[model samples]
Target: MGYKLNIHDPQDPTSLPPSTRSRLASGRRASESIRVGIPLDYNIATLQPSVRNAWIRTLKALHANGHTLHPVRLPATQRALSAYYVLAPAEASSNLAKYDGVRFGSRAEGIDGTPESVLFAKTRGQGFGPEVQRRILLGAFSLSAQAIDNYFIQAQKVRRLVQQDFDKVFAKQNPLLDDIAETEGTGDKVDVLLCPTAPSTAPLLSKVEAQDPIQAYMNDVFTVPASLAGLPAISVPVPSATEDQNIENEEYTPFAGVGIQIIGQYGDDKLVLDYAKELQAVARDS
Candidate 1:
């Protein structure tokens, strides 16, 4: 039998605890779900309502097939959003610091002009976004001799643990593992693991931007695990049936659709894609 796991609340309470509810209310959780399987083929510029429907139809076809959908949730997935932002920019700051003139890239044209100090300030301020600037400052502080062990080093450990959580659930072992099977299990060990691509369907682009940076960051919580583990995964859209049909409004949509992602072992790209094709076919027939 395929292994099954549920990352949702155990009690099935009508409402979540305040902290959890707040995250959910903010759309952080929903964003985390949808981005998992954004089609590589999707191009924002040319996206049309009809194309979205076509994608949904394809997903519906896949579900009609015999493929079983297993919902896998790792509570740690939520925490990962915080960890990734902390670690990614911490690393980016260090990596990007080399761009400083004299030691790295081209020096400013007005090095000796009036005030050298003001010139350097202008160059950096003009080059970076507020988010980028904040991260760079934070990263620089984290790397300071006094803070290295406390912040940077600890963040690295969290990153590893985050990766471990993913290795635990995926149907296949990470190929990067020294012993593939020993690290978790084999490819044939499980057919596939399934979960919401995002907590909800696509949000308006404006709404998406107005959300908190952390909330926007959560968009990748589900997908990032697969990426961090270097596994192959695909998102297939699952559209809800219409009103005249028996399906509920939440279950099907004419304007939007759900996405289910399929992840495979490192070298099993072909298998994953094949399964995705099968799923698309099933959704169409259904």
Candidate 2:
């Protein structure tokens, strides 16, 4: 998906770094650069109708406005998905352990002779989905004393590496970076990074359920890296021009406009939204 960058308004209430007032007072130019980062794997034909139209509109807008976009293809995005599933659930299991009946949840009443309480198992089994169950199991295994260092610890490292990969590719430096020296001369380090919000637009709930579990997992791959890094990101709908497309065609099918995501480094939340609004305007004009 193509993204247009535009100047941000300092008057908005959700803005960050009150320094925006100082910058405005200092009379610094408010023009922010725009760049679209389309994934190498993006196939226009596979998008839902509404999403496809939006992407087309965004591209047309950027072209008409003389805006240039940079393409970013991360070959490791697939691996990152795998790593996230393993790591996220493992972490969830650790974080969620505190919710046992004794600690912080509704307790089941029928407990007596069993070595393992049926009540706890029943509560969890009914509360979590299959995917959640799988993750919890994996997490439980990983956190066992024998597996802690090898599985849970290594997954944490992979998660860090994923964040580092993003930090390397985007034009902007991560505001959370402790050593600014490492990000020097990184080419304008863009005010925002643009990308496809999902691997594809939202699939029909039935179609999504029928697909392989792994495929469902891949849906979040594009959004995960940003989430892992604690960055600010927004998904904006890009509308298509026409409505006659087929409802079943996975690619080129008209549905909703593709969600083009805008991500910003920590503390640059206002900058991100300001630019998003600018892109929205650009999309409308185009």
Candidate 3:
């Protein structure tokens, strides 16, 4: 509901490269930049410096395009990431449990009725991928009587906190509370949140494959908070400043595909797409 446009002379802003976005915090023109909110507690340090610089350039480009940067922070990232690891696997375990040979899926022909348990085992063991199997085990353990309250139940509570964090940031006015008194949410509400799509730029396929299963999950750290809250988030790929600047990393070339995630408040699907389109168009024109 809060959308406005301003006209400014093209020559007024500095012609800095996209890479200067990080330094824009200290720049005099920063006051005129878009007020974008990056989430709080995200593991930004884990990202490679080049990747971080890539983000710097992208944000600076946006700033040059006449957007203001706002310091906004969403506080549920760590908790949501924790809850997601538990909850997603738990649901996957339950949902995949139905595929146990007899009721569903292909059955082993060699042993039919006598060794029913082995049949189920063989079917599942051969059917599901390694990661899926790992999740199933984790989920089963989490859902067990002793661990359920400690893991699954606590994860649910964290999920609610994740939702509340988003709602508060979006300045969601509760309909029920409105009858009693003004339940106006946060005073400084941003139209959308701009963040990194992943912790870093796209990693090499071979390097990604070599990562430990749990380590691979860390890629979703920045994403889980918004995802858990069921908000509409779009990862719009932007051209990297170092498109050909290959860093001397241990393995593989530098990631040239830099992605920026734009998230809208819950149910604001159109707003997310529209802004993404605008950003893409601007990038293309530039």
Query: What's each prediction's TM-score?
Result: 0.60, 0.73, 0.78
Please report the TM-score between candidate 2 and the true structure.
0.73
Tens digits of lDDT, candidate 3, 1-286 = 8753322335757333444322222212222333455565553677766557656666677778777655666666667778999999899999999898889988765654344364478778888999999999999999999999999999999998887766665543322222344446544666567877887667777888888987788888878877787777998877655443666545435446667788777545566777787778755654
Q: Local distance difference test, per candidate?
A: 0.55, 0.64, 0.69
Q: Where in model 3 is the C-alpha error above 4 Å? A: 1-35, 112-119, 171-187, 243-248, 251-255
Q: Report the Cα lDDT for residue 87, model 2.
A: 74
The stretch of ten residues in a row with the least summed lDDT in candidate 3 is: 22-31
User: What value does the lDDT take at residue 77 in candidate 1?
Assistant: 53
lDDT of 1 at 245: 32
Model 2 score (lDDT)? 0.64
Q: State which candidate, 2 or 3, has the greater lDDT.
A: 3
> How do the residues 147-187 of candidate 1 rate in per-residue lDDT, one tens digit apiece?
88987787667767756766665544554566443643342
Which candidate should be chosen as best, given lDDT against the real structure?
3
Residues 233-257, candidate 2: write the lDDT tens digits.
9987665555525445554444545
Which candidate should be chosen as best, given TM-score against the real structure? 3
Where model 2 places Cα greater than 4 Å from the true spot, the runs are 1-31, 35-57, 73-76, 116-119, 180-188, 209-211, 241-255
Whole-model lDDT, candidate 3? 0.69
Model 3 has a clash total of 12
How far residue 196's Cα lies from its native spot in candidate 3, in Å, is 0.4
Superposition error at 66 for model 2 (Å): 5.2
Using lDDT, rank the candidates from best to worst. 3, 2, 1
